[model samples]
Target chain A: MSRQTDSQSTTKTRPVPPTLSVITEGSPLSFVNPDGTLTADGEAHGIDIELTRGLYREMLLARTLDREALSLQRQGELNLWLMCLGQEAAQIGSVAALLPSDMIFPSYREHAVALYRGVTPAELLVQWRGLAHSGWDPRKYNLQMAALVLGTHTLHATGYAVGARMEQTDEVVAAYFGDGATSQGDVNEAFNWASAGSLPVLFICQNNQWAISTPTSVQSGGQIFRRAAAFGMPTWFVDGNDVLAVHAATTAAAAHIRLNGGPALIEAETYRMAGHSSSDDPTRYRSDEELESWARRDPLTRIEKLLRLMETPESFFAELDESAERLGAEVRDACRNLEPTELADLFGNVYAEPHDSLEAERRSYQESARALAGVNR
Target chain B: MSTMSLVGALNAGLRKSMADDDRVILMGEDIGTLGGVFRVTAGLREEFGADRVVDTPLAESGIVGTAIGLALRGYRPVCEIQFDGFVYPAFDQIVSQLAKFRARSGGRVSLPIVIRIPVGGGIGAVEHHSESNESYFAHTAGLRVVSCATPDDAFHMIQQAIQSDDPVIFYEPKRRYWDKGEVLDQSDRNLHEARVLREGSDCTLVAHGPTVATALAAALAAAEDGFSVGVVDLRTISPLDLSTLEEQTMTSGRVVVVHEASTFLGIGAEIAAAISESCFYSLRSPVLRVGAFNMPYPPAKVEDAFLPSVDRVLAAVDHAMNY
Candidate 1:
């Protein structure tokens, strides 16, 4: 293996793009307008309306869950909560376009993606509540556990995609990360491996502009989508606030990845209207005026306007509102009814086989706790 | 029966495994055309086309990361990490991803990836070259760590590790790669069990990897002095064969652990603690450990002094006997 092969290509440098663009421009993909109305031509399309409605419903459900989770945190129930407040369109739309056969490796902030994949809202809450690692089974939904580490999951997703190619499975893998993760070494390594191996993976960067206090300009000096082109991957950018645009771009990119046995990139250029999480106070870093500007392009409001302009019956809007209320109430009930998990479960699943050392440690802890309880009694 | 060195046995085992299963593929730096730095993967690239034996870039993370993907794709990828010290860059992939994938998938996916690394000291290697870091992988959940001390063990264990559905971290003794022994045509051996290389009743000397050969040599040296010492080779490091250990220690009534890694938080520390808990009453003397001191591996000239040689094992055994 030490012999240098002339067949290996020397590293080549490519031109970088100044700005991101893919499905945001004028096209049959645009279902909603900036004025919150469906264009005259948009009203004629039935698939666009249905997909927009689905995105709106999922977003509403996610928002309600977000609110309830925040309440739980404030009430001293959860250890922490990372709210997916304003990037619901990027999550829901991209996930909706993915076939069930495709595997998704998500960062911790993908509440809407988890919901779309049918993970019970309560299950997602339990993890933040400090009761479990991840609430749902990954196999049942073809989703891996939410990785808390920033860009590490990207490498895992790339490895899995390579595995898929070796197995000759036509399935694609999607790894979701934020713009802030672009700075991590693992993300760049993932790009290199996926490109070198030609793994079937879709790298979706939810460019919500801010990673905590750090802005996108600080995270990357150039466009994130163009970063993929240098790796020989086809890249796409979507107005992540627009559900229809996101769906179109992700669907197209995913198809390209599946057909070409190589990685593709999708930069969902969205904005976070709310603070990063309940623990964060964006007032310290961002201006209210800037927040309001992005909120004006609210994904839900845009789609709702389009539905109304399509002359979709008032009954449809009423049903959706009612369903949102039901979902909110259901989340509330589930949170209130969540049972406390055993402390032993933490050590139990750590290893598949019984580890005598861990077991001994657990027993010692139990004994100490019992002794303290006995003394108190 | 055929006599072969540890490296030669590993090569034969790999060839047999590749011949047995088309899904078994080898990937690592210098594993293909160069047959690895130690020639453990010698002739594999020529026999099995480049597809089955891949020469990866000089990226350890990439090798392990891609192996995970290859495993997901239903290919049994055996990754070589070149050296024990070089495995840190891939620690995230092995511990975080490789070890957790099967459990994270909730049994929906099984990762049959094997990572082989040349470990331990005594060949006068430089820094970041000689390390017994099996404890790190053994402590991690969803991984099986094992080391072979003899040619016969190497011949059998490699095939056993490949057949396992779980991920296995296979540590090869780089220093003992050329040490030869007679390897039988058949090895109907259990990979999870410990082997009693040299039996005695006075005290037991436990070791694995390069240290196992050293402990065996010490046992031989002890026999000349009319001292009866039991020598046990711990094949499985993760799920340690404590059953055999407890049985041997109870009969021997004393024990000494040996390894090349720093003593603190090393495999010896874990084994000593486990033995104390399990065979507390059976112990005639406190469990003693003979391992590298808690420090960075010394320079090549001082490596022979840093590693646990037969003299160090005998010294530890003498100290235990005095107690």
Candidate 2:
């Protein structure tokens, strides 16, 4: 039997960081520069003007919901909330580049992807409200529920692509994860499995600098994208904060897989502008200098600058601001009004088939509850 | 009815399932060209083609993790874990991902995936190859854990496990893989129900997987000594057929649970506790459990002493009857 061999070099080379935020040797691929001007590569990509405007609108809507969800967490309406405060461009741009039928597997922090995929504010907040383990139907949105267990969902995405291959579909399967998740063994295994099988799965690692308190410098030995090359996977490093760059890269990556090119990986260099979650305190671990630098390159702000430079109608900004407020209000209302999952409903879905022990326990619990209610009466 | 070995029965069952459903595919390490280490999946790749039977990279997590994705894509995947101890690497995916996918998705998504692991001691194999790890999966919610002791049960149970809408942890007894028995063309009972191999009024010996044959042997030896002992093959470990167990326990009035796993917190403990609660009045003695010591599976040379033997089972029966 012939072994699956890779033509890629096995010799390892140390990747020097170009800057504190970037992990690779070269500057990250960017379209919109920090100064609100398109880079030469960005101009050459020729992204549609309307798509750029839509990216800004989507990023703003995601930011609005994220801010309201964080505030609601502070007020104790939510049990917890992981802010996607910085990685909006990586989420919005990549998801927008995909076909609506393309499947997505997200690792918890992709609220932007969820909202872009048509998950309602109520459905998104229900999980954080401690009402349901998962809030939305995966089939309905073609987006899987948030996998809180780090990089595990990447394998599911690969396996889904394996199925897609048998069906001979042109659909691309995508998995969204963070740099911290790259440390997991499952993540590396997913990369190898997908590469070996030539599965049509795109691994988008939003290298958001910090995994809780652990920085990317200490978290990885070499560049995250460089690790994919060892698995013979096509690798791309992009400025995650640049929505235009991200959309273009993902569009090309998805097309490559659709054309039967093997699995690919895109390491999106971005920063976590907020704490890990409502529970984390980023101030203790990171610097004010770092925070200020990332704030200047904020995903929403970068696109808004480009929109202003393009002389977009002021009414477009006015209407979007009002829409953002409405989205925030909707999220706040959804978080507050979300119903708690009932005890009777809890055991219903544990198994698709009837389980004798679970059924018996449910009956016994109901009987005792009824007896206790009678006593209270 | 066809007579075949337990492993042959499983192979036939898997072939039938694949022939029956186009979505049924096999995934594991060495499952395709190698036909698996045990040869249970032999001749399947050639018959069904390489697409249906896959030989994956030597990663247990990769086998199960991708199976989860395939399940999400509307394919029923049967993942082979290679060995009992090797399953721990994929433990997170099975319990966290595959087991919880249905409930976590609020019943909207169900992973009809079967994780097949060859379980128990007495194989005289090296470390990590022979171990009884059923209790770990049975303890988990949202997973259906089952073990088939005979060729007849293996034939039907493997098919039933594949048909289940819920994710199943199917335990194939490696030591008994070559043991032969007659298998009917169709199943006579539900997948989860226990089977009474023999009826006795004095005591009942309960076992599953590799230990079922041992319990049957112990029952025959007990008959020589004038002690009538019944044997109950617990086909399903989780969501145990408690009614069948209680009914059989009532007949004997004395019960001894047996397994190759450590007695402490093994399936024996659960059976003992449940039978104690249900058959408290009828029981002549407290439920006794005969199993390996609560430690790592000993070396192959001493595995006979480590695994539950007929003498050890008879001793437990004698202890239960003494009361």
Candidate 3:
């Protein structure tokens, strides 16, 4: 395996900023200057006013929904909440590029993607409220549940894509994870399986620069996309804050994959504007300068800046804000109103077939309840 | 309808399952061309087409992980983990993801996957090749665990496990793979029911998987010694055949449990605990258990000392009877 990394010395020597976000315009790909402004040529290619306005509305709503969930957790209404403060552009742009029939395996914290896919704010926040493990039916939305384990979902995405190929369907699969997960063996194994089998799976890597508190360089050795490329797959490194770039890259990647051109990797350079979760405090491990630098290049801020250039209506902005407020209110109401899971639910569905032990447990529970309530079974 | 070995019965069962449902697909390492190291999946790739019988990468986690995805797409994927000791690589996927998916999804979706693993020892194989790790999966909430001590069970239970909509850990007694048994033309038993292998009035010996043969042999030996020793094969380890276990053990008034896994938290422990609670009044003894010590599976040369032999089971049985 060490020999397999023939370019290791070369690859390891080149310091590709683990969270570098470079924007390119036309042929030869001129970079967007450090000021975070895109070239006119890049803007003209796919940045339509409607798309910009749509991305802005979705991004703002995602933030509002995230804020409400965070408040709920703090208010002791919800057990815990993970804020998807940054990487909205990466999640929104990439997921917006896919058809609903195509499957998605998300490594938790893709709140923007879930919102874009019409996973209602109520359903999305229900899990964080500790009422249900998942609120919506994955099949109904064509999205699997948000997997909390690091890189495990990538294998599922590859397998699903392989099955689609086996059935001769042109359906594609998308897997989303962070840079820290790239170091995991399961992700590497998924790359091999997806490439060797020529499966139509899209690897969406949100390079949030931090896997919790660990820096990408400290966690990952070489370039993430390059790792996938070594496995005989195409690779794309994109500016995740640039919604147009992510959308264009993912759209093309999805096209190539649906055509059965094997798997493709998209390393979306993004940042976690908030702490890892509600329990985390970014002030400890990270420098203020770095946080300020990335915050200035925040995905929502960048998208808002782009939308402002289009002279988007105040009415449009006002309507989105109103909708976001309504979404926040609706989610809070749903979480509070959710019925507690019945005691029977614990013993039910352990197996599709009936089992004696679970039945006994159920009987024992009912009997205990009966004894408490002065009844008989 | 015909006599067959456990592995042969498994191959036939897999063939039948795939034929019955187009969604039934087999995936494993070396399962395609190499026919698996044990050849339990022999000729499946050719007959079912390479598309259906996929030869997966050498990674165990990848095999089970991908199978979960296939199941999500409505394909009843049956994954064959090559060996017992190597299954830890897939432990996270099996317990956290595969086992919990249906429950996490609020029952809207199910991962109907059958993970067929050839388990147990006495094969004189090297380290990591022989282990009884069924207890790890049996302890998990969302997964069903079953083991076959006979070829007939290998045939019917494999099919039954494939048809189940929950993730099932199917343990095949590797040592008994070559032991022939008559598979009836029909199966009238449920997938989770325990079978009474022998009848007795004095004591009942509870065993599962590879230990069932040892328990049966021990029971026979006890009978020759003027003792009436019954045997119960616990087909399903997770949702244990508790009713059958209660009936037999309570009737006999004495019980001994046997397994190859560590005695501390193994299925033997589970059985003893359950019987101690349910058959407390009827019990004549303190539910003795004969199993391996609480340690990793030793090298093959010394496995005889580690595994519960017929004599060891008899020793436990005599202890129970005397108590």
Candidate 4:
């Protein structure tokens, strides 16, 4: 393939800011200072504390689920499980900002988002457990099914937003992807369509710093938020590790998108403290020191510290942990006791009406299997 | 009601679709002011405005990715890939998301997205411009892959592809874009069924897209000899329309499959397998395929020789009949 050297060289020579200046310019979006003290302005905001506490509980719950799912995979229960160990804050905080009417298109790692949308732990486990194709019906909850492709869902979300606007609906659509997805051509194409149509879409990028083994630097030249400005969408950068910051950023961004007809982007600066998936090993590409440094800024830990400083009751923490444990047990049992999938189920729902050839093939396969089992006798 | 080239017919079909449905939108690189490199989207921006007819950045994956988002929001997006070979950047979206969305959503979400790709060789284009990547999409479960061989089919099939609840990969044969044919005002034909373009009794020749024209030309050449040949245009690649193919092969007792893609794992392989299984006892000879060899599609200078031509189809038909 001939290298498109001119474009690459031009992009490289362009002087770009290191990150979004909005974070430094201070707005109502920040909850904690760089020194970890609660902002005096934030303490006066009652809803901010409640939302942060809720986010903390949910992130912890998500981490518990992640651990259990990984264990299940090791125990030969699931075929595979993509862990969102270090991404709970990004998922929970971003999802927490969604209105009931708003829709979310998530990439596969957004387990917390599904939970926030009311998808039961059992239902979510079915997909990785190999018992079901999708976790739940998208219509029942505004959350669309998880997409495994890196950046494809962005287009689907943009199309959905355009559709919503055509109907004059007030709903906004949010698409969640990772930093690595910024390298995908579809991600950029989505920006084009969303901007041109002025569709009501909130494009959230959870910049977890890696696309599997590839690092963020390899994916793009600089911050992904800058790409949004080029597409004519106002972009924001948030400390993804801080749930309060993530929630505020996403809420503000979604509000801007709903009030305006165009798209907005939020690049959550975060880290993936865990391996990309159960099958991945971070030791191959990253060092333990880097992982430990990110762990210190854990989203859950910061929220817990803030809650403690406020002298929140011990019962609050106790109840939250208890509930998380119960949720984990329920998920484990559901995964272990999953029923064997029937062969007929595969062909039953491929189309609205059964296709004639598919039905014939199904019947033939059933008859042959019955003969082999001696059931025909 | 009017006659137009396959490309013109497709443009008209898109115009009608956009006019009929406000949710219908056109998106791709250079599709706006430039009116598409091939002018397939000419006059669309002026007619529909920039909102409905969009010129996206040069990112194939992003175009398809956001189209998925737009589809979820209930908009019907028709995305253009510029060329077939350039589609790889967006393959993750097409195969993983677009192809699996309906099933993944348990039928709750139906992606009414149509991805238009200018496919097949003979365009004398650079690398990634001329390719036959239909087999990859056809093999994917949730997607429907179809191609148009004539202007009538182009005019009708493009609309049908847009209307289908499932995402459809609409492959436009670049080489046949300028080929003109009569397009009727109304089409009551089933989009999934294979059509018999010509009739014969000696052997059955199966092809689609660019090769459909080649198959017809070869059938004519064979008529000049003492051979009678039947031609079946496999418009839908995924569904295969094997029932129609079985009927044609059974009548002829010999089969030859032709395509612009490589022979290995190409559409021909599936058709050959289906014919052997469906009409095993009625077959007079083993099924033969005339296609590009297993290699990266050669550079444009040699693509004419690499593509399946009328001579290659005739040669394969001869080989099949000799049994």
Candidate 5:
């Protein structure tokens, strides 16, 4: 059978989602309404104006860096790049809600989350530049290294959550993945385990609409949030473009986990505004009109409108622009200054302890390199 | 030390290891309540509590995947994959995640996880259940694969494997689960070293896991035939301790490798390749290997023919002796 079909056809007993009717350009779960004002549920939109402005600033800086990284890859400085073009609010909101002790396990594209966690720009680009396996030290941030496998980090996060619970630590775990990852067996297994163990894992899946070319509607029969509910996780579907909505949802989810309420799956509905990567051309699969529609509902632009509603002056916008420009410059220098990795790194880190067989191979390669040099001379 | 069955010794070893370290967790299907199918983890959950000896959902990937997380969280998890054939579901976790995490993390974090699987064929069990799929793991880098032949090694090695600061695939020969031997107070043996069981001058019988006893029996029979042969119990197969293998080759000048797995691209093939490279001048004859032919593990009724027995090892020894 095909993976994604109409929900009624897939399961006769399962009713259509109640919230499916309310999911227009605006969702009731959204904190910031279509009119650019906070929704009636004040608790859900509890984040203050100060924090909202800070989130906007962080998102803007992340966007600046992401664009420069994309440009660098185009210029042949980086091997390849995956940009967080439209999912900045989703990552920024959820990461900001997390406590300092909570561990984060992110899939490869969570660049903004890593930056917010104090991972330097040079550390982020070194892996893309073909210098190292991972840029930042995982233990330092209580965040794991960027996992390339799509859905695997969910299981890792669940396991880590279970471990922390076992250790009696109140620290929670959050795993970040895309919409496509929901289709993987690892993610399903992760769901089963988290529910079974009553593990405190905040599963944040940025449903960015496209998995390379496959849309979410084609990835699964039902809504992504519905899958989590089936696994008995407290599931929340939010408008990911609204930073306030994401922050409020994640804050509640984090509190639920910290209070021993078990795992929660928050599916942030967003869009991937750019191609899948530097190698992809989205025009081949998706039409420009659909892109234009999403471009109009851009998260940054929506927040800018709200900032004006709050009577924020032009100087505030000017200061943000100034900081973003400087941040972009720093990212450029960081990517350029990363030193090339030595050949010895390949032989190193194979094992914590010394290994005779690997050492012999390393020695053999060195001797051959020297021989080739002599011949060239 | 009392005389104990291999499974009993393993159970005792697990209990001791858990007691020795509070962080060691045991997870697998039916392990907690059912005490595992083979009862290898019998009586563990009661003492350790349900939290420590967890009865995981019937998902191998989930078991290994979560164990990797627990390892990251500073716990040494020993995961039991129900049987040999059932291990493929967890293969990705073992190979990609558990095996690669420590090295890829640049030595900052260590995954001290143990994946214990009952391997090899015999006892008329169904297909899938009876398998010797050790080579797939042994071939993977960043994994330590070891097997135990006797109760003494089973008792001692389980603790040692748990103690290592790396992921170790501990394969227990299921056919020999009932085999009895004295559990010594302690064995002054490192976890990865090969052991010289019996010394001879004519040939060396190299084997591991299920086939080690067969090789030993072959050596005894070969002695009566005036073909003095040595037997080496290859305890660990990954960082293969070939120094003992080299010693066997140098002493006898002729050696025969044995395993229950298919000889085609098998662990025996690796042994032969290493011997050919290192013992090119010291060897008297080509390293002959006796293993199951490259075919699916046959039905139980015909498994005796498929598995390497004492006769097959002796036949290989005779062939090498003729050389």
Candidate 6:
């Protein structure tokens, strides 16, 4: 998991600007196409069949868990769930490419990375189920609590990289955000900060076409990756549906950062196949034609087509299907079995230091609760 | 012991803190090389190096936002917001992110970050240079807000805040930065406790930061007028050491709270409400408040009339005593 390079070439001491031609080119760098074939760039990128298969399995598990959580929301078992339905490759691929010790500050919708990092179904569901403000301890997983305020976490990731560099650590910090997040000032400042400092950070923009209902065209003036160029960061525009492309790009970017080549931005162009959240109705603003067009270029379907073309055994698919079913059942039970939070628990964690005012408030609340209990009983 | 100005004392405190712990770093605009606009961070960059005392990009949100990240990585970051009025740009990061991270993480995360804001109006600076917005952070649940009035308090309190595990909004009275006083080798009081600067029997004058001096001056004026008025410096704003406030209120039987912030829903309102709740029967008169009128901080030339002055404090004390 540690990408600690022994030494770098003297030329690598200074940051190497990204390939301008590739970034300026409008088309996304697609590795695996829908026709069960690799594109020219994909051929040059060279797919690791074994790693691709593992990535596909992770995506399948994510897809299965995503479907189950959405069902739980619909059944009123959970309060809300944001689906990682179509951006599986973007999430799984980018997370897998980074070192396990690399800290990640993710936006609320990075479910696949959370699961991959060993955050349990119960831990992930507690927040969505209205049980807790946060589910898992970030220190345990090196993953921060989901930042609901858009684009704020990018600065966190950049600052973390700065601190890590000051500590002389080789770990590259990463942030997962969306197309809309690129428009935020904090995110732009982060780009400039990381670039100016030559800090090790990988900004992964999962450009899922729609920020709720606003399409990428309306969300940004130009391609999201091009925005990074303005800050002198290495930029890559990759097919988010192609897991292999994301893995390659991210792995390369992480290496460059480790080699003191500074921060990099990768825009993984994918589509959000589901409504923004359980509460959102995307059909109101988008067309069925657009949805149908994206469904054909689905992240899961292309990976499956490639695996089938490679004659990956039927047993692998069969075993994975069994695992997915098991996962669905386990998540359903976990969501239902989460412990309810108490009124007193809210007061306990406001500050690490002792606070007299909060304690007083808690005591008053306890008395009121007791009075209410006496009346009800 | 050394006699120094508030600016010099703060610089010494920060130097001591950074020297004591390698993790303590300072980040803000003009803090590095420039030594801050008020020279509070003077000579720190040369001693601590560029990495430790970072001059950040001119983005308030970025300064606070990144400081939170640095705190997460086990660094104690003290961010200097250039001015009180300039803090709004970083308001969301301070209020929504830095303040809430601990509770949001269920106490797993502790952001030992200090936001040093030079606050209040008096210097006759341009618009947006003077403000007393401590009420905003004080009203928020997760933050600890404190202000320093004298040189000694500025020296000790800045060091204490850096060591605090909770995120602290540290307000330095801008107008009082150059006021000189003796700073002790170490403090004998808790960071959040209110101290009775002067004792009297007739009435109590409560204030913090810049207003503490005015309250003390008013207390002296009241003594000359044959009225014994006490002065209490409320160093802490949030957890508000209500016991001391209540004790003073009961002993004097009358109370007057003053500050540079607007009286409308300011810290005075909370103190008045708390006093009423705890010691209403002991009070000989209703708790009165003296602060700026409810309006945007006026132009610099007129701030002297707008800010709580010695006269304003004496008027409140008089009102409380006569009532």
Off by over 4 Å in 3: A1-37, A40-46, A373-377
Backbone clashes for every candidate come to: 4, 0, 0, 30, 0, 0
Order candidates by TM-score, high to low.
6, 2, 5, 3, 1, 4
Candidate 5 stretches greater than 4 Å from native: A1-28, A33-47, A373-377
Cα error, residue A12 of model 4, in Å, equals: 43
Which of candidates 5 and 6 is the stronger one according to TM-score?
6
Native-referenced DockQ of model 5: 0.66
Predicted candidate 6 versus true structure: per-residue lDDT over A227-270, tens digit per residue? 77778887778889888778777777787778764899999999
lDDT of 3 at B239: 82
Task: Please report how far candidate 3 places residue B88 from its true position, in Å.
Answer: 0.5
Superposition error at A138 for model 6 (Å) = 1.2
Compose the digit string of candidate 5's lDDT tens values, residues B1-323. 89999999999999999999999999999999889998998899999999999999989999999998888888999999998999998888889988888767766677899999999889899999889888999888888899999999999999999998889999999999999999998889999899999998999988998888999889889889988899999999988888889988998899899989999999889899999999999898999999998998899999999999898888888889888
A313: Cα error in model 5, Å = 2.1
How would you class the docking of model 5? medium
- Give residue A164's error in model 1 in angstroms: 2.8
Give one digit per residue, the lDDT tens place, for model 3 in A8-97.
221111122222222232122212323446665364453456656666666777788788888988999888888888888788878877
C-alpha displacement of A181 in model 4, angstroms?
Answer: 3.5
Across A160-220, the per-residue lDDT of candidate 2 in tens digits comes to 9998888888889999999999999999999999999999999999999999999999999
**Alpha-carbon deviation at A327 in model 5, angstroms:** 1.4
Candidate 5 lDDT, A134-166, residue by residue in tens: 877887777798888778878889889888888
Error of 3 at A68 (Å): 2.0
My TM-score estimates for the predictions, one after another, are: 0.87, 0.96, 0.93, 0.85, 0.94, 0.97
Chain A alone, model 5, TM-score? 0.90
Fraction of true inter-chain Cα contacts (below 8 Å) kept per model? 0.38, 0.92, 0.74, 0.54, 0.59, 0.83
Best by TM-score: 6
Q: What is the lDDT of every predicted structure here?
A: 0.81, 0.88, 0.82, 0.81, 0.84, 0.89
Q: Mind giving the per-residue lDDT tens digits that candidate 3 earns over B1-323? A: 99999889988988999999999999999999988889988988888899888888899999999998888888999998999988999999999999888778877778899998899889999889888998899889889999999999999999999999889999999999999989986799988899999877999988898989899889889999999999999898888888898899877998888888889988878888888888899988898888999888898889999999998988887888777
Off by over 4 Å in 4: A1-21, A24-30, A33-49, A67-79, A164-170, A188-199, A209-233, A260-262, A271-274, A279-295, A349-360, A375-377, B32-35, B44-47, B123-127, B293-306
**Runs with alpha carbons beyond 4 Å of true place in candidate 6:** A1-22
- Report interface Cα RMSD per prediction: 3.2, 0.7, 1.3, 2.6, 1.3, 0.8
